[model samples]
Target: MSLTDSEILLLEQLIHDREVDKLFSRLTTITEETNPNYKLLFEAINSQKWGFNDKNRPVV
Candidate 1:
């Protein structure tokens, strides 16, 4: 079965949101930690800009 354009778009959005949510959760956990090793990882994830690309696809 083929998905309609809207359905495909919705699915893509859901996936993107889930990934961002996971990243945010990880970031939160890292923030709560005292280990300095996580600092760089937290910074990297925090500095990442998430948005849709020109093709309307999610970019992380």
Candidate 2:
């Protein structure tokens, strides 16, 4: 699925604006896994998971 220039521009703008939720909503059904913004989107989605220590370890 090739995105037109306008779509590319919007994606870029979303990345620039850090509009993660809006971007994620728009990208939900995307077929282009290699889209350049994918990494940025994935990072944005996972950005808040870095400080979690819930590793599911059993406690005595």
Q: Compute each candidate's TM-score over C-alphas.
A: 0.51, 0.30
The lowest-lDDT stretch of 10 consecutive residues in candidate 1 is 26-35
Name the regions of candidate 1 deviating beyond 4 angstroms: 31-60
Candidate 2 per-residue lDDT over residues 1-60, each given as its tens digit: 899999999999888778777676766644665586876786677665434347865433
What lDDT tens digits, residue by residue, belong to model 1 across residues 1-60?
A: 999999999999999999999988776775545468788877787899999989999888
Cα-lDDT of candidate 1: 0.85
Q: Alpha carbon lDDT of residue 7, candidate 1?
A: 100
**Model 1 clashing-pair count:** 0
lDDT of 1 at 21: 99
TM-score of 1: 0.51
Which prediction has the highest lDDT against the true structure? 1
For every candidate in turn, the CA RMSD to the true structure comes to 10.8, 13.6
Residue 5, candidate 1: alpha-carbon lDDT: 100
